[model samples]
Target: MRGDSLFGDLVRAHRRRLGMTQEELADRAGVSVRSIGKWEAGQVAAPRIGTLRALADAFTLTGDARDEFLTSSALDDITPAQLPLDPPVFTGRERELAQLSASGDGTIIRVVSGTAGVGKTTLAVRWAHRVRHRFPDGQLYVNLRGFGPTGPPLPPGDALRGLLDGLGVPPQRVPADVEARAALYRSALAGRRLLILLDNAADAEQVRPLLPGAPGCVVVVTSRDRLAGLAVTDGAQLLLLDVLGTDAARSLLARRIGADRVRAEPRAADEIATACAGLPLALAIVAARAAAHPAFTLAAVAAELRTSRLDVLAGPDPAADARAVFSWSYRKLRPAAARLFRLLGLHPGVASIDALASIAALPPDRVRALLAELVQANLVDEPQPGRFACHDLLRAYARDLSDRLDSPSSRREAVVRLLDHYLHTALAADRLLKPHRGLGPRRPATHAPGVTPTPLADSDDAMTWFGAEHPILPAVADLAEESGLHTYVWWLAWAVLTYHERRWDRRDWIRWQMRAVAAAERARDPHFQAVSHYNVGYALCELGDLAPAHGHLNTALAFYEKLGNLAGMAKVHLNLGIIARRRTDYTRAIDEAETALALYRKDSDPVGEARATNNIGWCYLTMGDYTRALDHCRRAVAVHEAAGNHMGAGHSWDSVGTAHLRLGNPTEAAACYRRSLAAFRSERDRQYEAIALAHLGDAEEAAGRPRAAHEAWHRSLAIFTEIDHPDAGEVRAKLASREVPPFSLRQQIDRRP
Candidate 1:
């Protein structure tokens, strides 16, 4: 008979001999009738170890027959000559297994722990298989069903009874008392070298009674937790199983699906491994699917798996079978912990402790304790220090539970409070960092005090805050849009804009500007919309995209005119002048700048007037009118100084220095550059500092001081490199043409001056 027909014949013959129908076997095994039929008919050739054990129990198959059936099922297609197995093909766990195994001799109770699908069971099975020969008596295996939907874990007394019966103790002879049964179990394995494998043991209490006290025996326990109590109390060796190495995952794939197939589809195989995230259970499921369907390419399977993680995780197994594994773990969580786990799925991104606390509105310390419980249950993952994220599959499961457990209004309120927390904190930071950029009228604050609505102390604190929170900002923006919280979206967008501008992040500038514009449009707020359009246009001009810049700027100008906002109109015209200067339309640039300057003077907006005057100087410089440029730049500098704006003063002085350089006045240019550097440093603007340094280098060279010029150029280059500026390449080119002085020489210049 063929392999399938032979397996079917054996299953049928075994069932009939045991006087059990397929339905009876299915009921006893806690599986479906169809699944049992498929197994008997060989349509589904391999049953899980759990199903096989249930069948064996129902059949009353004991002694050699039971052992032979289990051993054959475990062997699968391997020949009798290779029946013992070589190291059981362990992957991603050499060091851990070796360390655990080397923890002295005797009946070492080693516990392997990790999050779900992290290969805890695989390591235990592999380690047990390696030392099986050392235990000459026999090897015993049991799935405690610790994390499944069926119920609580199999009681220690029951597991002990199975082990006793497996070692030849008849059911009638088994003791009813738990302690007596445990004692009997220890006696059964006395002086025998038996290797006991307890897969998915719930806790130390469940496992302690089952351990054989005989010095020659060894026991391996696998669980989805650290089992710290077991280590502290029982001195059990503990091995924390992490994700597999990339190469080992590839090797696992190659083993199941031919090496040639893996090589032919290397990229897809890599993607499959990454999608599985080095989890053994996931990889095994994926590889098994690939093996069972020879016609389905690995890429096709990988693509499908990426779209639906839970669906792929279920694999060819029935939903019931997959839930059996997950529900067991879920059942073990406390009521509050389980609720928190489901609610956490509502979080928009990787969860921080504060954000989680804010969403739950619980004390930080209390929420942290609950998170620990969920972590212990393996329902959540604490991947890095103070950061927690759930697997995509687990997150989806949690989301489903959230919907089932929480009211719609409760979920909405939780999400709203989270958004409010982020918005209020961002506003606070914005106020502290850019106090001059007035955010018209303040909205009524609704968030509570524990949320801590305050900004950091300095620029460094601001940078750190933005950097740490950057990953979640976009998701927060998305949530704001979804929740129809238009004001929150636009204001948050505006606040983040300053950080992006300070860092010269063109991509983020464009992204947030677009979001701000959309939010403004949704709110029908014309003034805010005009501001968004203007800033976005300015960014486009900076990026050298002129046509779109002109279009957006013109749209913004029209909006400002309609709203009769003269300040907004003047700012738009000034930006337009800058754009025209970049396009080399000096005449149009001069015209726009002059008009903006006149309007700013009329409004008595000194800051606006100074900015417009600086633009006028820039236009003249582009047109090769050095005298005219110098006159406007000087006026702009005086106006900026009178306004007490150090940043504006620095820009004006830099322009003045450039005009002096063009006019061949090295001494005047150097003086202007020195003054500009002082202002730029005071403002903490590195970009301007680099420009001033470069100007100083040009003036020094003009004064016939090559060594001093080289020192200045090298200093500027270092600044460029430190800031990751695009101009670093240009600075490098300049450095390569000259014998640059050491940076140490420039550092000592202040002492000499």
Candidate 2:
């Protein structure tokens, strides 16, 4: 960073360290928030160095820090004013905006390039417009008209004339010679804080002359080419723009078409975005079409685009036509690359090189070369090494083309190979996640000649694989079910449920669980249907959707009883016991837990017995039967330890802590709570950690340390808020009541008796 801005940087850093917002820091410094923003933006103003000294004093800098602070802020740097109007449909470049903004520490030269109509110019213009106040000196804009099809791209010499003109140099004084103009332009921008946006450049050579040879000036260049030369020579940060995400795309459509109209057809909005591949250019054209025909339903547009994507995305302007924009890049690809791009449409999820290799019937090395060519052309993106996917629109375009270019049998064969790859890989990962399962292992599919399963070496690999593949699971399931692969459908959902269920991701759990239940019903397997109900019921119960949970659980119980499945019956009873405990029906809870425990013992399953014992001990703790709760909880802990269930043991330790607290043994209770907290933390179980923290606070208060108790409650409250835990309200209430006395109704001690 330039020394002139160091003080501003330091002040901003320290303010952030103190977790103060700009307004709060401004208040402390006895200045307007606008002043603080200007200072941080490296803007020079009239207030002189005293305003900066006030800022340093507010931040409480001392010694060398104070000396550095005063030195950095004392240098008054001119701000530039060089941005233009913003595009109407600007949305979702938050990450790129931050990157571009922070690149100001040194020479701020950023090159934004993507396929045509990817909103490269829109992003650059919007960002520059927003940061206008930072550049008080001046803002200069010059469009080179590269790829505009409006004559040829503007020459470098002519571009310099436009820039020099914006800098207010007299037209006759501007040199006719390109090299002389470049030197003059450099001299003009020297020591002046300026923002230079060289838009739609044909190439690096076109943009190279316009760059200011000054530290204070920022240059943003947009182009269709990657402009590798600029990055290699001038050290420009290259930001490759991709299609907007689904939510952002929906929001973009809503902006052009009325929000009320979009909301009325919310599904159509999402469908349109999907069909548009979240490309801003395509969405804008579709929105414009919708606007032109106010009576046309968005669903009709979505349906039309689904079959004729490239056709519907067309407009009067070549740039507004999504297909035309994509074709510009697509036409640049080699035959092999173009063929591979077309083949990707047949694959359901993102394709790994090996999967693509099998689908294309090519060698891995050969496939990599083809994919690299497509990547360079920006027609395809390799999000990770050896894994390739295209934006939604690109994929649709490819699919539509492939349906004609490739034989139907060939596409069907490619899909099967892709399906086989996922199904086998999922089963392998599921085995590592849960080696022992209620259901038997999924039998390996008879692979096609070239298809291979994804190999997961261990549990960690399996988990990483699961995380990477989870987003693709829903799509994979749909493909599997549509292909009449019912076993694969149910198995895929069941496997993912096992991996994620314990993590308590209620949304994904509920979604996939429903899919699994449907798949199981289609399979006409009684055991599978009952087990699917059990899985979903458990998830719903955890989510506090008790009404549905009760019906699912009861359905599972009846099936298990009819099927004479002792283990399933015992598990259902244990879950029922938990529901009873939630309602504080301790007597019924104990009865249900006892029945589960007896069945578990009869079945010789220590894990099931341990789970039941823990539930019963939890009930005793709730009833304030401290002595019995502690006894049962200790036994539960030992059994859980024997069964090697750390999470189960953690819950028991927590119950033991609560029992000790109620029995007036605060120190012991605190120690047990600490142990439980540590166990949950190691497991990364925030839900249980919050509960442990709340109980720990109770023990802290019992030990006469109200301050420590307050901290514990606050810590618990934050986690509860993060997880949207049901106990959040209670914790918030406790924190609020910490400084107040509350009315209490309690039974008087009858000492006379």
Tell me, by TM-score, which candidate is best. 1
Worst 10 residues of 2 by lDDT: 743-752
Put down candidate 2 lDDT per residue, 1-753, tens digits, no spaces. Answer: 111344456667999988999999988889888766755664422233566688778888899988876764353333334466788667788998887788456558999988677889899999888887787787888888776645678999998887776766545445566876776577667666777898988778888988887688889999877787899999899999988888999899888988998999999999998887777888889999999999999988888887778888877788777766666666656788788888887667677887788777777889888887777666777788778887777787788779878888888787777777777777777766555455544356477777767678876677777778788878978887887888777777777775675455668888998888898899998887888898889888888887788789889998899999889999988888888888778798899999999999999988778778878878888887779888988998898778766677788899889888889999999999998998776555667888899999889888976766887899998988876778989988888877723323431233225
Q: TM-scores of all models?
A: 0.73, 0.63
List candidate 1 stretches off by more than 4 Å: 1-110, 131-144, 154-198, 204-220, 230-324, 442-455, 482-489, 518-525, 602-604, 620-646, 656-724, 741-753
Q: How many residue pairs clash in each candidate?
A: 3, 11
Taken over the whole model, the C-alpha lDDT of each candidate is 0.76, 0.79
Measured on C-alpha atoms, candidate 2 has an lDDT of 0.79
Task: Please give, for residues 1-753, the per-residue lDDT of candidate 1 as tens digits.
Answer: 112434456667887887888887777768788766755654434443455677777777899988876656531321111112343456567788777678466677888877777777667777776666766677887778666555678999899877765776545445577776776577566666777888888877888899886687777788876677888977788777777778988988888788998999999999898887777777878887888899999899899877976567774344223334565677678887887787788777787777777777777778799999877766777876666777655676777778878999877777776777777777666655455564655553567544533347865566667767878888888887788888788888888876776566768879999988898898998988898898889878866778888888998999999988788789889988888888788888989998898888888888888889999998888889999999999999998888777778888998999999999999899999999998877545566688789889889888877777877888988887876767778767877887645547665776485
lDDT of 1 at 707: 72
RMSD list, candidates in order? 14.3, 17.5
